[model samples]
Target: MTAPLSRRSLLGLVGAGAGAYLLGGCSGDDSSDDPDAPQTINWWHIQNTEPMLPVWAAMAEEYRGAHSNVTIEIQPLENEAFKAKLTTATQAGSPPDLFQSWGGGVLKQQLDAGLVKDLTDDVKPWVDGLLPASLQPYTIDGRIYGIPFDVGMVGFWYNKDLFSQAGITETPTTWAGVLDTVRKLKAAGTVPIALAGKDKWPVHNYWAYLAMRIGGLGALQQAAKDGNFDTPDFVAAGERLKELADLQPFQPGFLGAEYGSPDGQAAIMGNGGAAMELMGQWAPSMQASSSTSKKGIGDKLGFFTFPTVEGGKGNATDAFGGGNGFAVGKDAPAATIDFLKFLLTADNQRTSAKTGAVLPTVKEAVDAVTDANNKTVAETLASATGFQLYLDQAYPPAVGQQVNDSVAELVAGSKTPAQIVKDITQVAKSQ
Candidate 1:
């Protein structure tokens, strides 16, 4: 599981800017290479945990076990460190054979660098049946470049026990209702929502959701693709986000909180002090790790899509997210593609889904989940009217950073809607 897409998306998007690269791999200096020497396929990922580390180990083991002639090496690093290393490796012309990446814009950067291989021929049948919206991010010039392993939507994950204690019976379904609910929750001595604004990424999610509610998915995507930040639609979205920020719905000093830490936010929600969390399916894993997991509070957690602004162009079901998946690198051995094809089969996806990792991208695997919570997430994703790729991935990197920074400043009362619009527009145009 990753940081909530809404907040983390922009950060991840603005993330891999030029940095000190870590260049370490097989020597390109080998003089007499046996043509039939087994290929070593390096798989890089940011799994800084025992639990996730084993998942990757299993993937590598299974892949290598089957291919016999191919050895898959797993390289795990801290998130930021991984990007820096990737930047270095690619520049050094000693990149990994395959690696983990978000399926859209992140992959596009590598694609442009001539670092990633076009997987269109191998993935066509699988890509063809994807949800209509899922196709756009992976398609660069009408060719597929990545396989989506986990695709899910972002939403409000709430503490139902807190809601019930506050006498609220149902999840709010519109923007007005969200405000009203937050007000009641705050007045009742519960934190209305948890926003880790210090991270900057969570703040980005607020802006993207605000924009989608005001302008709809198509409008937001259009602005992103055309690099038009000053459109009326974007301005309206900025204003709506500003309104949400002014409500002071987050815990005091939440603007100074570290987001990537699961314990901090989970503690607030699990204690029944926070009514809702604007997050993704990853919330479930956090819940599982909480003290409340045994007390039954974890089981009562509820989720709903971010509500649409009433009478706004967007539907309540419009969502924003991307699938995290594997991408084959340029010049990968034949066995590498075979390994990916095997691992991506419907059966393996179901196995991966059981880890509470994410909503599987394969339609059939998603249908096969028996867990109720996982199923709810699956159903919510499948039911979405459309999904906007996380804003960071939807736009250029610098533009994404400006949007993220604007939201953080706006929420802290250091900027206004007009100011944010101008700042983001300037960045977008410059990009």
Candidate 2:
């Protein structure tokens, strides 16, 4: 499975005044006679493990075979290591020809510095073949800067068997109903939620979704623009999260739980020790990998969109998630773009979906998703009214980390709702 979107670090890599120096040159031959020219495309991605690692290598080999004059150099790095290496490379005014990108605030920064190519005209012929929502994160100020290969959204991944045991006849549709569900699960002697408290990203999702429900999508963008997050709606989001925490809904010793470890959130749910977890489309694969039996709960797993908050302005269809994509570096060879197009063909996407590693972004490849749980997530995202990338990816690294830190303190009962918002606001302004 792909690593969490929040693992990327964008700090100091694309700061103010860095753009001017990075935008100095253009690379790649636009001439027609370049077909015979030998070229190399440096590519980097974070799928360092199977299914995707081999899948990507196979795709690259195929592309290379098709173009004997071109060579694809693939570097599969761990999540955090990729971010660190990319930071050093970009800051040195050089980036791989094609590299992994989450495509939000960080991509915007890179684009501002002219470190990446604008693919609007180049990809026009085939861009429509992909889902529009999946492209949302890569499109900045009316131009396309990246191409998405996978897409997904965050929602409640629950054990249907456990819900039945808790006597819940229907899935909750509102915040009150969710709380009631938690109460019922607890009363029935089940852990209502499994949280990876050691990883702040999972905790941030609760506050982020709450804010979206309370203030609507515009509130987040507006806050980022104004460098302020200490609004009434944001504070109320924290309070609502506090209400959920007050019920003691998490698994025992959850404050130190890791995300992918044997004793982590996914394992708890996969092993039937917990009723639910709020996670992305990749949850099932993660559950299976972390489980003792090496197989997840299978058909016993169910999913539902996050519940609406009473009197909130946001629509239920406003989705909160992000996905993976590829960005072209400023100095890449012309053949790099061709290799990218080749990698995203319908057949390639279908193969990727078959691996159950991605929620295919290619519209034609959607039917190839054999996993039941992922199919549901793809359907939900297809009809979404709006999309919000994870907060950690949607903002500058420092601001995003501040959100995680503040929310973690709130979850641990060390900070109040007002103080959380204030802390986040202070860091946002500094950015």
Candidate 3:
């Protein structure tokens, strides 16, 4: 389930640089001219695969069966495809009535353009029923614009058997220990880490986590505040990542590896070709699906939160990740939210959890998570002292892309740690 919060104690962690913005929703005639009139909702999502795809379809069909007056048209596209088409649609000002949202600077950009609805009033009645940390990424400047269905953090997903083979007894809790583990794994003839370098974005995960570990959440918020990413903390993050890079710990030909390809990072992890990977909650399933046998590592898989840097400002419990949510477009019919509410019910969330793909955002549905590795993630997130969305989603597109690009080069040995920070700062300033 989502990052557990004891009721709403964590809501005060409104996140960094998330100061103030005048709340406003785009003005449009409500599609429902009559309260119970026939309605049609256009929905877009990126869950274009089995388990989730059919799960969403079943929910929509169930809603249609119950409410004969409603018609929901869903377009489940591939991740990059959804982003491309959504960009084109938003540019044309005709987005779907209900669409997917990751909730960060991207959502903020949509709001600033008056493209999405302000859900503060609409969701207030039951918003608190969900985990406060789950709502953090979707909350901006004191306003709620979207509702997350799943929330989690990025951490080390390791093969327990491989660790045991390497004679490692426990997961590392500090940066120095992690490096030692990597070296030990290498000494044991194991690939220390599985990275998708060709994809670029995946490798950036390490640098982002390092930034959080070294600088703390406020540094990130302050960087966003001043539009500057050239700080000692950030540079130090790059250097630390470079230390890992210099160890040559990634899988062979990792520089050309894709994430989901037959021989890519996930497959490497699933097939036990590597010791570990830095990834999100979905890694296990991705590894399973990409592996030759499609059975993955089974019970041999384990999860661990990112380690702390000895004297870093960030807490050991500050999580770095994000999740998927739904945003009601400005022009949506009243029935749109009615359907959304139906889909998010505790029973439905449990149904989603059983599929092993989603981490339910509803606090009451936490028990539905039964997988051992998933439960560990749920517990880790539940105890997180702070949360950070993925940098690619948390920052504006240009800046996020630059971070990915520069970090990839850093890992590829084309750019030094100093060069990457300088490069990212330039792009951030341009933004």
Counting only residues 3 or more apart in sequence or on different chains, how many pairs clash (N, Cα, C under 3 Å) in candidate 1?
3
**lDDT for each residue of candidate 2 in 1-431, tens digit (9 for 90 to 100):** 11245422111011011110111122244343476676777888866544566688788877777777766777777555677788899889898899988888878888877899999999999999998888988999989999988888889999999999989989999999999999999999999999988777778888988999999999987997997888989999999999999999999888898666669887887788899988877677767756777677989999999989999888889988888889999988888888888878999999988877688889889889988888898889878899888887788767777888898899999999999899988988877
lDDT of every predicted structure (CA atoms): 0.65, 0.80, 0.78
Best by lDDT: 2
RMSD of each: 4.6, 6.2, 7.4
Provide the lDDT at 113 for model 2: 78
Better of 1 and 3 by lDDT: 3
Order of quality (TM-score): 3, 2, 1
**Top candidate (TM-score):** 3
What's the count of clashing pairs in each model shown? 3, 0, 0
- TM-scores for every predicted model: 0.85, 0.88, 0.90
List the lowest-lDDT window of 10 residues for candidate 3: 4-13
lDDT score at residue 413, model 3, on the 0-100 scale: 90
Q: Residue 254 of model 2: what lDDT?
A: 88
- In model 1, which regions exceed 4 Å deviation? 1-36, 78-81, 88-94, 124-135, 270-273, 290-296
Worst 10 residues of 1 by lDDT: 7-16
